[model samples]
Target: MTPEEILPDDLMERIRGRAAGYDQDNSFFHEDLAELAAAGYLKVFVPVPDGGLGLGLEAAAALQRRLATAAPATALAVNMHLVWTGVAHVLAARGDDSLGFVLKEAGQGEVFAFGISEAGNDSMLFDSGTTATPEGDGSYSFTGRKIFTSLSLGWTRLGIFGKDAAARNGDGELVFGFIGRETPGHETLTDWNTLGMRASQSNTTLLQGAVVPPERIFRKLPVGPNQDPLVFAIFACFETLLAAVYTGIGERAFTLALEAAKHRTSAKYGGRSYAQDPDIRWKIAEAAMAMDGIQPQLASVARDVDALVDHGPQWFPKLVGLKVRATENARAVVDIAVRVSGGSSYFRGSELERLYRDVLAGIFHPSNEESAHSTVANAWLGPLEM
Candidate 1:
């Protein structure tokens, strides 16, 4: 199905209307989540036979971009669930059914969340700060903290990873597994208050011996980077979907700027429309040009992933590049929108004001500016000559 069909204009308007309220109240998008779930939005990656939309990654990215145009925080939070399901879909399409359960559970209406982020583990997917102690029965107990756990209140299954320090004869292994919300050892702190994206409520999670049975354990890769399809799938889905959200933000900002330029009259220019002002026209054109370049990149990368295009070592660079470009461009567009929309946008309840703050969060996601640059550099220049 098309993005418009998945998220109708009326539904988007309702979501847009709730965004400011959720931000002001510093609350989760409970209503939005319920509405989206009821609309079968959370299962966009699940197969048709499993009762989902059965759309590809490109389509899923489009849907997310559409969702973000209405509510960025909600879209950001929902991205966590979609990431896991998307990863499952990616892996399954590659003949790996290891995460097939994710699809099944999601199709059954269970919410899956991405829980791999840590406080200071910059190694990202390559390494883990969390400890995964192996059990006698092949299960594992995870003990560590996972920060920025989005959908904290709504996730039924959280996909997390940690290092089993004792595995591989002390070489260590990164253990990936899923823990249910009913698990007794994890706690979600209500400390998500932030400068923006407040509705995401992405609080920190403390895992105090959260155990996953062998059945839930999916991958056990050696410490540090490797050529695992699971890694590719996670990075591909996370980065592309993330880019889609920010691209949507940029699209919305550009639209708002266009409207402002057309309607706002300039007193200094004899009450003429700002659109007639040369500077305002220039800013609008700048935003439009910036936004125009991102959709094609987002579309191409997402389509490649869905089609299983093999970029080899260049894949990481492509994924990270798309994320960095989309996010940075979106921030620039929001900034321009704020500048063109006049001082009223500075008000707390103004959507442009909120977007300005929300867009700043793009710098904090994985494959950040520094990381993206490093990845691309290494991909081109080869790893630093030690």
Candidate 2:
């Protein structure tokens, strides 16, 4: 495709049209995102050798920012693949043979979801109620329920984690298994709903005696008694993408508020333009300022991500700092977006309402304020490495 056809001019317009009814219609745009996947957006950063376009981080970041402005949830859901898949691809490129098949499958639009969060683990992943005990035949019986397994039934494979069953000295490791969701014992319950990003279809997947073959394991055992630094580094990048989506939600809210206020007629004391209301205009201006103030930092973090490819493992802590600072920035932008939109914005069909809900997704990501801060500070001054 030529430059004119490169981005598909109708993409943004299409997303905008879907934005109004995204929660109630389009059936989650299950088909449209498939087109995006076919167009290579889904495999944007996977290397060409792995049957991908290898558009690189800079291009991916640009696309990330652009897509967030139109359909934030598409961007949100895509991040699940984009952030982790890309990092996993990078690790695969380094000759991690275990991930080769997974990366190749992803390049062909194969879908996998990260299943990290769970119920009653007390917030610690390793101690989750779920367990995968080895059955002595190179397969394991994974037993437990996982809550908030976003993209539950729709996923082709789920990156399930459990305590490594083969620990000799009692220091166990996290074993990531890419279990097929269609397995007989694996079932999904889409009974849960959220205040925002309803299209995320984030639901619970029940695993009762779900047998996982050893071939399904993605990251297994340790790297010769050492852990991979890429895990934490990749996590930092996901948080940044979340921050980017939050930033875009605020921008959309600001745009909608400006357009609405300019046309709204003041009802009190002889009709005047709502734009003429001194207080309303002032609030809009403040939101605009907040939007302007936050974006430069976002841009800087994008640049730092590019720098990561060259800086290597040392960039882990820096990327964590970026996520820590920017998630707060995104939360700030969403707050201002809601404040400027006012009470009417709370209406079920309002754009601000969806944007507000979508932005909240960032605050709940694994690398929220507290987690990111702790990681960054530990990397900086800890006596024992975390």
The model with the greatest lDDT is 1
- What 10-residue stretch in candidate 2 is worst by lDDT? 220-229
| Model 2 per-residue lDDT at 219 | 58
Model 1 residue 300 CA deviation in Å: 0.2
List clashing residue pairs in candidate 2: none
Put down candidate 2 lDDT per residue, 1-386, tens digits, no spaces.
23124346686777667766767552355754766776777777666887777654445655766677787877777776666676665555555555666667887778877666786564444345577777787777777788776665467877776665456456565666767756767778866567667666677888787877878765554413234645643554565676666667767777777877776677783677768888887878877787787677666666655554455434545565655555556556666656655688788877777777777766676655676666567666763444
TM-score of 1: 0.99
Candidate 1 lDDT by residue in tens digits, 100-204: 999999999999888899988999999999999998999999999999999998999999999998889999999999999998899999999999999999999
Give the whole-model CA lDDT for all candidates, comma-separated: 0.94, 0.66
Clashes of each: 0, 0
Candidate 1 segments exceeding 4 Å error: none
Top candidate when judged by TM-score against the true structure: 1
For model 1, give the RMSD to the true fold: 0.7
